[model samples]
Target: MVDDRDLLKVVSGIIGEERTSDDCCMIKVGDDNIILSTDMLHESTDFPRGMTDWQIGWMSAAVTLSDVASCGAVPLALLLAAGLDEPERISGITAGAKDCCERFGAELAGGDIDFHSELTIVTTGIGRVEDEYYKTRRGAKPGDIVCVTGTPGCAGAALEGSERYWKNLVEPLPAVREGRLLAVAGVSSMMDVSDGIALSLYDLSGSSCVGFEISMDNLPLSPGVSPEMALYSGGDFGLLFTCGRDILPVTGVDCTVIGVVTDSGEVLCDGVLVERRGYSHRWMEEI
Candidate 1:
């Protein structure tokens, strides 16, 4: 069966790989570069049964805004498209969306609505990035240290019906602040870990044409999370970056050095080849 990646590849063939592949599309606006990105959330697929409307809205907005942060851009505004048959929950969703944007120093500009059988939310974020602070997955070089903000495996634990991890899974807090900090510190390459780290590593490798050797002992795993879940589960929207020596101090967050870039064109986990896979829409259905 065709997956999201396969479909994206087809789209990339038409619009050019660079434009279609990146999380956000960049455009020159005078001396500054504007970043624009969009992400979608559906109730059946993205939201679990117990999630509140507030958490749903917050997560939807966070996912899109995270893309802007991944590009080292400061978010300015968001546009939301919420489709739902249950109009009563609209207020909760709106309130949550507004709150998240405000906390991140951004605005919930405006959006459209439609009626649907199930709830659906689509968010688009617009942000600005200074030329010098802009970063992408393409700049990783050999000898650069692979780093990550925050921890992983919480989402995976939540997926396995672990109540202890519900907050981290449902109310995901993206590393926007940390991302901007890394950008200013001159990180060579970066991306958010929406997919599993293994898949993300493969993506970084593909983009930069480099390899990675990850030390399993270095992974910052959440409590009760196995290495497989930490490596393969999704919904941990932390920033993964590659940078030179002399790591910059990211105030208010613990950044961990998990690995290093190599010329081997493979992703190794504790000196073993890790399978290249990650959670996608199709993968989510199986779960």
Candidate 2:
């Protein structure tokens, strides 16, 4: 079976490594750098059961904005394309997308609507950042501290029948403010933990050419969430970052230093190799 990351290698082959390396593609525009990203969500896959149309809309917008945030960019606008199963869903979806954008300092620009068998949404986000402020997943160095914002696994817990965490899964918050703060604080590398902390660490390791030594005891798990869920569950839109110890105690952000970078180029948890497992889309080869 081939996964999304394996398919990304094909994309990288065609687009060149520089273009395919980051969460958001960077384009130089005048004195600033513009970062652009897009995401697609479907009713059958991305959205969980019991999520309202409003939450569906919000989640669609959030996923893209989260990419923008990962680059430490200030979101400026978003374009939402809705393939609706029912026309009535548009109203709730639009309202939710607009509210999320407004709350995150972005605008919900006009978009396209089309009829479809299942509700689907495609969102494109545009953001701006100074050349010096933008962060990427390729700068971590040995000895840098690995940190993550907010408690992961809340969404995973919600999926496991925790009613208290339902909102966390349905309407996950993008760490836009925290990304900017981390960039200003000179974070070496940063990305969102939308794909679980374990997989995210591997992605960072691949890009930054460094390894991680994370302490399971230091992970900030949500109440009632197991260690496995916190490490491997998806849909947590928090920032995972690496920085120097001199920059300890980043202000105004709920982040925990869970590990440190190493030159070994392998991700380890409690002195053992961490498995490369997470929420990834997979396709089996026909035999």
Please report the candidate that would top TM-score against the real structure.
Answer: 2
* Ten-residue region with minimum lDDT total, candidate 2: 278-287
Across residues 49-71, which tens digit of lDDT does each residue of candidate 2 receive? 99998999898889899999999
For all predicted structures, in order, the TM-scores are 0.96, 0.98
lDDT (0 to 1) per candidate = 0.88, 0.92
Cα-based RMSD of candidate 1: 2.3
Q: Give the TM-score of candidate 2.
A: 0.98
Q: After superposition, how far is residue 189 of candidate 1 from its true place, in Å?
A: 0.6
Per-residue lDDT of model 1, residues 208-229, tens digit only: 9999999888999878998788
The segments of candidate 1 whose C-alpha lies over 4 angstroms from its true place after superposition are 283-287
Residue 265 of model 2 has an lDDT of 99
Model 2: runs farther than 4 Å from truth? none
